[model samples]
Every structure is written in structure tokens, then in C-alpha cells.
Target: MVRARAAVAGARAAWIVSGPGARPTMLELEHEQLGGSARSDDARSTLELSRGIPLANVADGRRGVALARYESARAESASLARALTIEVRATLERVRVLERGRQVFDRLVALDAEVTAAARARVRDELITPLTARLVELDQLRVERRRATHAIALEEALVERIGWLGADAGAIVLASEAVEPESLTIAEDTIAARGREDAPAVLQARARIREREAAERLLAREQHGDAHVAIGAFLERRPSETATADDGGTRELGFRARVGVPLPWGTIDRMAVEQARSETGLAVQDERVVALAAATEARRAHRRLRLAWSQHTRDASRASQIDADLVRVREAYRDGRIGLDAYLAEKDRLTESRLEGLESELTYWEARAALERALGLSFEAIASGATR
Candidate 1:
């Protein structure tokens, strides 16, 4: 292929030193026949042929003839090497993807630890109740741990699905890279928007109305039933007789046939048309209603995005300014610069603000994904509203 590409159109070029050659070899056949009943005997036949139909070895007849023989052994070795190289490259890429997935799960594990520490500190300072608060914190910890474990399992399964392109888990276990997550938020609007296709189910109840209309139209068409046309033909069979059949001089053969399409008149088709209309109306009406509800959800996501942007900007500034302050927010609560309740409230508020920022970013992506669905486009499918 590379050599072909190097030659320009109509350009004189050197010929190949060698090309692929055919091989003539063995052929084999086998046949067997047998009777199921004991009364009959079985039969079998087989034929095998080997080293057949060899081409003329030109070297025998042409003395001192210059012929190029292929050094296929070397070429075959190189081809094998290239194939192995490609396989290794693919394996490396798969390994890298799996490694990234594992890293994500590792982060989740670290986040669980942080949640634990925060709960302990809060309890020690009497900022939260020991029994109820501790129990709540434990539940949250378990959930986070489970999430991390589930992520690990999912990544492992993904590797297996990709033909186990890397070494075993033990060989590729990542070193711990722990960082606790400070925020958690859900994108409900995004979820609802993505599931909008369920709106089609609303059309089912109105299908009967459409069916009735169709039946009425069909009935009307059927009223004009049994419609056909007839025509006579004059033939000169055995023309030597001259104007025989039509002229009554020879025997006449009359052929009659009828063909017509039956219409439904106004009965059946009308019912069907009505049914279809009803079904379509119901489907459309409910879908519009559902879509309006969905639009509200989309607007909510939009509102959240704006709120998150504002809060994120303000909190980021506050955090930056407070970086040099020695007084811990928790200490402030103990010292009454802030009440215990007030400090916890502030901490919660700040944590949520940060989480909202992150969720807003995620919501943007999710909203885009949802919009694609609402507009009936997948990621690869170009959206009418989308710019290039």
C-alpha cells in the first residue's frame, strides 16, 4: 500500500520485486450412510489427496534466467512483530483507563474517612448529639464506603468486559490517594428531563378514538363496492377464415373477468380514523402537559445554576480572605464568637454552598445531556438548536 501511494498517476515506477504466490496442496473428502433399523447395514466411503497439481518449476527449463525469489520468511517475521506491537499498544491503553477508574474509587474511600473525622470532632465539641448524630454519621460513613466499594467492583467488571487487557488486580493496585469530598448534591431536574420519553405512554388511552374514526372512513369507502369495468375483444384466430368470430362466421370464445378494490364506505374506516385521531390527540395533549412539567424542572435547574454561581463566587472570596485567620470556625463556636448552633449552621451553609457550585457544573453537563434527549438527539446526533 505504501509503495502504491508513492507512485503518481501515469508516472513510470519500478515494479515489485515479488508478489504473493498460490500454493497447490492436499484435498480430502468423506461420506457415510447408515440405516437406523437393525435390519439394514451401514455404509461408508472416504477419499484423501495430498501434494496435488504443482506448477511448473521454471528454474528447470530456463538456464541463467534472472528471476527474483521472495524472502517471505523475513517479511512474515516482521508482520508478526507488527501485530504483537499493536496488541501491546491496545493493552496499555486499556490498562490506563482502568487505572483512572480505580483512582476515582480511591478518592471516594478517602472521602468516607473525612466524614468520619468530622463527625468525631463535632461530637467531642458537643456541637451535635452523641447518640443520634453519631448514628447518623455512621450511616453516612457506611453509605460512602459502600459507594466506593461498588465503584471498585464496577471498574473491575469493566476491565473484564474489555478482555482483561491488563495484568491482574494485584499487579495494578493503585497507591492510596485520599481526599474527602466536601459537598454532595443531587440533580433532580436533569434526571427528569432525561426520562421525558415516557410521555409517549399517555397516548394509549386515546387510541380507541382514532380507531373509531378510521373504521368510519373505511365504511364510507366500502359503500361504493363491487365497482368494475367490462370490454369486448374481436380476435382473428385462424385468419384464413376472414372476419370469422365477430362476424358470426366462426365459433366465438367469450372471456369475462371482474376486478375491483373493496372500499370501507363510511363505517369501518370512519371508526378507525376517529380512533387514530383520538389516540393522536391524547398522546399529543398529554405529552405537551408532561413537557410543560419538564420545562418547569429545566427552569429549576437553571435557577440552581444561577444561585450556585452567585454563592460560589461569594464563598470563594470569603474562604480566600479567611485563609490567614488562626481562629477555627469550630473554636469560634466554643468561644461564643459564634454560638454552637450558629457555627454548625454556618459550617453546613458553607459546605452546601461549595457543593452547590460543584453540582451546578455537573448540572450544566446534565442539562445539556437532558436537552439532547428532550429534542430527540443523542450525543452523536446533531441537535437542531446546537451550533457547530
Candidate 2:
């Protein structure tokens, strides 16, 4: 993103300094000193200054071509920025999901310890068989291993987030609560429409096509070449060689005017024009390809976002019910109404629900980010339900 912005700045500066309509006239100064000259009897010196103004730069339509190129650079920069934003958002969401998973696993590991201790006590009191106690211990070890895995995954995700957001992000605290799924009320047709005109990829391709078109026109105009007018004045001084000696030797002052008209018969000019025409045709084809791909991606993203949100909504509701069920199972196990195996099974169900919910939430957010990128819309705009 930083690099893209810097490129944009550089392009802007270049356009202002050297692009269309800048420094219309070229200026030059010349000076010469002669001593012991073959054609002159005395030493001589000359000074000349001239300005050549191009009269064909604007008339040839190269100015429009330069402007088109500048605009193309801007569009490319915008596309890069949008891609970066989408990537950053997806990475942040992934980190958040991993963190939540780690925390949930941590709590589960502690709960497993309590369950294992209780199972051992029950075995000592002869309330449960040794095999049951062994099973409980094995489940505790498994939970511990899963917790360790989550911890490692969380660390990796944090590092990834830091890579995207910079070192300072390492100190930033993420919210414990998960983000709710965004609503997908906008129609897929709207997204397809917007993507064709507003998506970064499509916009960039369109800009480049226009730039190439301008270049083609400019090249065609160049076949006639540019016209320039130059005017100069010069002063020359030398020792007088005439019969009569002058007060100040000899001096000559002269003015000159020149107009240049190219014959426009250069082979390079014809080749360049042909190349530009071929490139313009390629650019036109590229725009079509880009537009088609952009629209397809936009529709695909919209479909995925809708399905992910739906799945997340269902998972969220199921998770709430599982939470209530887990509370009852825990109470029943403590009250001796449920056996160790039954209690463990219920706990596993709750764990499955939590993990599945987390996965669904992550998927939903990822799809949302993808959709935002596809349509060239901001997160805020999507969240505000103004995707149209």
C-alpha cells in the first residue's frame, strides 16, 4: 500500500513536470571563441541565444495521450490499494478467529483437568470403574494437546497479522467477542453492475484502454511530425581587416528566424504507428476480458457471502442452544445423574459447536471481505447496507 501511494505521487509529479502542455518552448544559449582562425585574420568571439517553440505538440493530440497515461497510473494505484485493504482485513479476521479458538481451547483444557480429577476420585471411592477413570484421563490429555495446537496456531496468526499491519499491531488487543455476520441484502445484479464500472480491475483495464486509444491517435498524428519556430540574435567581434581601421575593430550583429517542417517519410514513424494500432487493438480486447472476469468474480463473491452468512447465522443459533445444553450436562454430571462417558460426550458436543461456529464466522467475514473487494466497496459502506 505504501509503495502504491509513492508510485502515485511519483506519477503525479512526472505528469506535472513533463506531461502535456508543460514547457512549450525549448531554450538554448551558445558561445564560441576563435584564435588564429584559418578563415579570419584576427581573433573572434560570438554569443547566441535562441528559443524553439513547438507548434504541433497540442495539435498532434499528444497532450491527451499524456493525460490518459497519468490517469491510467492513478487507476492502477487505486487497484493496488483496494487489494491491500482486502488482504489486511482478511488477515485480521483470521487472527481474531485463531485467538478465539485458543482461548476456548484453554478453557476446555482447564475443564478437562477438573473432570479428570473428579473421575479419579470416583475411582478411588469405587463409584466408577478403573477403565472409566482411564478414559477420562485420555480425554484430558487429548484436550491438552488440542490446546497446545491452538496456542501454536494463535501465535502464527498473530505473527501474520503483525506482518500485514506492522510491528505496532503486536501490542494491539483484539476484541474477545466475534464479529457478527454482515447482512447480504444487496442484489447480485447490483454487484455485477457496479463491478463492471467500479471494480478496481475493470476500472484499471478501462483506463489503460483509453490510454492506448489516445496513444494510437497521437501516433497517427505524429506521422505528420511536429512544427517548430526558432528565432535568435548573435553578436560577433573581430579585428578589422579592411584598409581603414575602425575605432573598435569590427563587429557584426545578426538575427535569424527558422521554421522546420519534417518530410514525414521516416520508416520508424510508420512502424511506430503500426505498433500503436496493434497495441490499441490488444488493449480493447484486454478491457473486455477484464470486465468479464470482474463481473464473474463479483457474482461469485456475492453468492459466497450470502451462503456464508446464512451458515453462520444457523451455527450461531445452534451454538447458543449447545451452551444451554452444556450447562445442564455439567450440572447433571456433578449431581451424579450422568455417568463419566455421558458427561464427556456432552462436553465434546459443546466443543464441536464452538469450533464450528468459529469456523463459520471466519468464513462469513472472509467472504464479506472478498465481496467488498470484488465490488470496490469499503467495509464501512457494506456494513452500512449501502452496497448499491
Candidate 3:
């Protein structure tokens, strides 16, 4: 099976996107502190700050802070551009990594196909030519042998879709005549390394987490207000509670007044900061754990492939021995070294041995394939790169 080839030379476009808008996160704390003063001044009109200036301007001030969070979201439009810049670039890197192996797979398919065809031709040239089916021969002698099997095909599975790659199925390659069935090899380390990183899914998840964090921090920051103390000298012409019987029955006095609170941040924003912190911790841990597991899986797959290769030579020889034994027994019996019952018994043994050897060979090949799949390396990338 083939994996999706990474585009290399004609690097279609960069996949990773990081840009200026990503800078906002850097200033999150500073903005959280300063943004309030700007909003308090600008939003006083909409927030009815003047109408409640005396008693409950507190609520109005909090509302002014809330508007800042909304503004933060508005500015986050920059992250989109940021994200695009990085995404396209990461994709191009991935493409380049894959293209190298694809070249090898292309040649592999051709060689394997040639050998397969040659095997078929050999049977036709040497075996089929001598076996002239004759009705008259059957009439002359009652020795009639029914062909037990039809096809001489050796490969258990058709080498269909040589470069067929699917989701990280990049490591496996088509078997060439020289590359023996079930053997695995790799060209690029980056493909495996990237696969180990599990970057795409991890990045996507991180994006959502970061967005939430920014928004959460905004939410928390709004809870508090600017740390300002009012130093106002209030000259009162009238007092609201009662009329002072000073001189004219109507009260008029000159008094200095100061009104202020430390800041609204503790009440309006700190809780949001705490929540964002917890969420960030969770996101980081999750990505770390997932990334580690993915890398371990890839590495394990790679190790298994290496082990499979170690056994390939021995398996091939064993399979060859079994084939030779089957051929020798079958010929001896057919040439009358044994009688009918003995011939039948020897033929049965040979068939079983041949079948077992084929199964063993197929098993080895399949194991090699599983190992390759783990490596996250693909031959198709090589071919595709060479094509471009």
C-alpha cells in the first residue's frame, strides 16, 4: 500500500502559519493591565458613566472593562494570517521529506513486475512446452494425471497500488526483484521524525487551546479595573441629603472631596486568569503525552522492521529448501521410484510442504510490511519527487 506523497521540489505551498498577530499573546499581561484605562475613557459614553458618577459608577466601570475583551477578539484576526504563514511552510517541508522515497518505489514496481512476468514466462517456456496434452496418449495408457493447481503465481497478494499511500502509510514500498518480498528500507529521517511529532493534529488542538486561553485571559482581565485613585477637589454648591441652615436656607458650601478605589481587577478579572492558567496546564500536558506516545509507536515500528530484515535471509533459504524437497520427491515418485500408494503419500507430503513454505513466505512479507508501516516512511514520495 502507498501513502500520500509529500510534495518536495515544486513545494506547492507552505502549511505552517505564524505571523505578527501571534504577537498579541506576548503582550497579554501588559494589555490586560493598560487596556482598561483606554476603555474607561472611550466607553464612558455608551456605558452611562456620567449618569451614575455619584453612587454606582462601579457597575458602569465593570461594563467598560468587558468591552475590552470584545476588542481583543476583534484584534485576533491577525492570528489567521499568522496561522496561514506557518501551515503552508510546514506542509512544504513534509512534502519534500516524502518525495525522496517515492522515487525508489517507482523503480521497485518495475523490477518486481519484470520478475513476476519472467517467472510466468519460465513456466511457459520450460514446463508448458514439454507438456503437450494429447487425447491419444490417454487412449494408449490409462495413466491420466489431473493438474492439481492452475496458476503458477508466487506472490500471495498482487502488487496493486505500488505507491498507494494513506495517512502516514509512508514506509512501505513495492518489492523489486532485488528487494525481496517483505523487506523494508527507508531514505528519509524527517518523514519518520515528523510522523513521530504528530504535528498536524497536535498543532490543530493547540490552536483551539490558545484561542481559549487568549479569550479567557481577556475575560479575567475585565474583572479588574485600572489601579487609579481619584484626587479630585470637589467644590459643592449644594448638598443632596439635607439643607444646611447656614444663611439662605439653601445650602451652598465649598468642600474638598476625593473619590477612588484601588482598582476593579481583583473582582473583575483575576478569576479568569486562574481559569486560563489551569486550562493552559491541561493543554500542555495533553500535547506532551500524545506526542510521546506517537513517537514511541513510530520508533517501535522502526525497530520491528529492522528485526524483520534480520530474519529475511534465513527465511528465504528455508523456503528454498522446502521448495527443492517438494520438487525432488514429486519427480522421484512420478518417475516410478515408488509404487502407487507410496507415490500418493509422497505427493501429499510434497504438497503440504510446498503450501507451508508459501504460507511462511507470505507471513514474512506481511510482517515486513507491518514493520514498514510503523516507520512512516514511503517509497512513493521518492518517485513523486523525481517526477517533479
Best by TM-score: 2
TM-score rank order:
2, 3, 1
Candidate 2: where is the Cα deviation over 4 Å?
1-55, 58-62, 170-183, 226-264, 383-388
- Tens digits of per-residue lDDT, candidate 3, 147-217, equal 11212121111212122233433344423321443323443354345544533334444555555566555
Clash tally for model 3: 54
What TM-score, to 2 decimals, does candidate 2 have?
A: 0.72
Residue 242 displacement (Å), model 2:
28
**Candidate 3: global Cα-lDDT?**
0.39
The C-alpha TM-scores of every prediction are: 0.31, 0.72, 0.37
Tens-digit lDDT track of model 1 for 77-157: 443454444444334333443454455335434543454466567788887667745654664466466557656755655
Q: How far is candidate 3 from the true structure (C-alpha RMSD, Å)?
A: 20.3
Better structure of 1 and 3 per lDDT: 1
Error of 3 at 121 (Å): 31
Q: Where's the lowest-lDDT run of ten residues in candidate 3? A: 43-52
